[model samples]
Target: MTDTSCIEIPEESSSEKVQQIDLLYKCISKLKEADRVLITLVLDEKPYEQIAEITGITENNLRVKIHRIKKELTEIFHKYARL
Candidate 1:
């Protein structure tokens, strides 16, 4: 989650599922190994401690990484929304 380009994808359904999936594919492709795990844990709304446990990263490190990921997602959304 350190890319600052990942968007806050919705949980609700829409006719644009395919399009959203495409976007997800593109964004996920750019993530690093650690970022991918962090992103999934976050999408599942897993708690901080859980994320740390699952990732084997310290909670403080996880928090910083999550912040970076959120920033990356924001940038990605801004760039891809027009696509």
Candidate 2:
């Protein structure tokens, strides 16, 4: 028998997802170029070491930056989400 336990399901409808994506992109666009690149790399699932090498930063710094970027992105996303 096939294992279905690992399968994931989405709670949002297609249109809601599209709208959320649109809002996310809008928020991302407002970020600085470096922040945009960093966030994109994270979203792409690049390893921390690789991301640090590419960004020329230490792993600890990268983690801190990622945390801050996410916080900023959340704020931006919420600001746009209300509109």
Candidate 3:
């Protein structure tokens, strides 16, 4: 899986943060409901084990799903950022 841990979102003021969140929700809205939930939990920084338990999947499988989800989100985010 690709390493995404090094990526950092810069901290911004409250107004900027709201705009960023709006963009995020717009991006996530394109995903399936399950994938939207997965991305939301991930952005919340929930641990892998907890996410696995909540999703009723094994940690390994959860990791794979998260990896794919992150990659998709990254693409969407970048696409939007360019606009």
- How high is the CA lDDT of each candidate model? 0.83, 0.93, 0.91
- All models, RMSD in angstroms: 11.6, 4.7, 9.1
Residues 1-83, candidate 3: write the lDDT tens digits: 98999999887889998988899899999888999998889989999899999999999999899899989988999999899
Stronger candidate by lDDT (1 vs 2) = 2
Q: State model 1's lDDT.
A: 0.83
Local accuracy of candidate 2 as per-residue lDDT tens digits, 1-83: 99999999868998999988988888999999999999999999999999999989999999999999999999998888787
lDDT of 3 at 30: 85
Which consecutive 10 residues in model 1 have the weakest lDDT in total? Answer: 1-10
**lDDT, residue 24, model 2:** 89
List candidate 1 segments past 4 Å from native.
Answer: 1-13
Per-residue lDDT tens digits for candidate 1, residues 4-82, read 5676866857758887877876876677877987988888899999989987989999999999987887788668887
TM-score of 1: 0.68
Query: What TM-score do all the candidates reach, one by one?
Result: 0.68, 0.84, 0.74
Native-vs-model 2 lDDT? Answer: 0.93
How far out, in Å, is residue 29 in model 3?
1.2
In model 2, what are the clashing residue pairs, if there are any? none
